[model samples]
Every structure is written in C-alpha cells, then in structure tokens.
Target: MVKLRLKRYGRKGQVTYRIVAMNNLSRRDGKAIEELGFYNPRTNESSLNVANIKRRIEQGAQPTNTVRYILAKANVL
Candidate 1:
C-alpha cells in the first residue's frame, strides 16, 4: 500500500518534517515517490501542495494519523 506520511529531518531537538508519499513498507527516511509539503512544530508553520495532496488521496494514498490532522487543518480533507 502507498501512504502519505511524515519523513523526519532537521537537527535533534529542532525537528522538521517533510510530507511524503511512499510505499508502506519503506523505511521512514527512505526514498519517497513525491514530496507534498513541510511542517515545523517549533514555529507551527506549514506549507502544502494542496492540489497534489488531494490528487494523491483520491488516487488511494492513505495519510498517517498525524498527516491526516495536518490535512484536516489545511481543509484538504
């Protein structure tokens, strides 16, 4: 299954995340089919590719719980 999920990056204690589309069995930081957005908890900032996200979701990519919340906040779902 393909899933839309977060890929952790940035430095320790200052983490950021890239919203990604990848196979469910892939490694957390493995290669992703596409990058759809970014999030930074420290600043509560987010940038998203809404069109792509909707397209992906319609095409059957499932978001992780956290990603789902972000999408909801962005009113994408």
Candidate 2:
C-alpha cells in the first residue's frame, strides 16, 4: 500500500517535515517515491504541491492522520 505521509527532518527541537509518497512498510524516515510538500510546525507554515497530491490520492495513496490534518488546513483535500 502506498501512502501520503510526513518524513521528519531538521535538528532536534526544531523539526520540520516533508510530505511524501512511499510504501506502507517503509520506516518513518525511509525512502520515498516522491516529495509533495513541506510543513514546519514550529512556524505553523506549510507549502504544498496540490496537483501532485491530488494525483497521488487518485492513484490510491492514503494520507496519514497528521498528513490529512495538514491537507485539511491547506484545503487540498
């Protein structure tokens, strides 16, 4: 199963995330098929590639709960 999920990165206490498409069996920070966007919680900021996201979702990629929240906030889903 492929999924739309967040990949944690950046320094401790100042983490950020990359939105990506990957296999469900992959680890949290494992390889992804493609990057779709970015989210920075500390700054409450996010930038997304809506077209890519829609394409992925249409291809049967389910979004993780947190990713779903991000998409909701971005009005992408």
Candidate 3:
C-alpha cells in the first residue's frame, strides 16, 4: 500500500513538512516515491501539486488524516 503523508523537517521548534508519497510500511521520514507539496504549520501556508496529487489518489494512494484535511482545504479531494 502507498500512503500520502507528511515528512517532518526544519529546526526543533519551527517545523515544516513535505507532503509525500511512500510505501505504507516505511518510516515516516524514509524514502518517498514522490514529493507532492509542502506545508508550514506556523504560517498556515501550503503548496501543492494538484495534478500529481489527484493522479496518486486515483491510483489508490491513501492520505493520512492530517494530509487528507490539508488536501481537502486545497479542494483536491
């Protein structure tokens, strides 16, 4: 199974995330099949690759709850 999820990064208190597609059994920060977007909680900012995301979703990539919410906000799902 493949999943769409967040990969944490940045300094300790200031975290940012990359929206990624990876195998379901992999570590959260492990290798990803593709990086589809970015999100910054502090600034509430997001950048998405909508076309790719939609393609992945249609191919059975399941988003985590948080990622799902983010995608919904972007109107991609």
Model 3 segments more than 4 A misplaced? none
Residue 58 in model 2: lDDT: 98
TM-score of each: 0.97, 0.97, 0.98
User: Compared to the true structure, candidate 1 yields what TM-score?
Assistant: 0.97
Candidate 2 regions exceeding 4 Å error are none
Model 2 earns a TM-score of 0.97
- List per-prediction Cα lDDT, in the order shown: 0.96, 0.97, 0.97
Tens digit of per-residue lDDT, candidate 2, span 2-51? 99999999999999999999999999999999999999999999999999
Clashes of each: 0, 0, 0
Ranked candidates (TM-score, high to low): 3, 2, 1
Task: Give all candidate RMSDs, comma-separated.
Answer: 0.5, 0.5, 0.5
Deviation (Å) of 10 in candidate 2: 0.2
Q: Number of the top candidate by lDDT?
A: 3
Write the residue-wise lDDT of candidate 3 on 8-52 in tens digits: 999999999999999999998999999999999999999999999
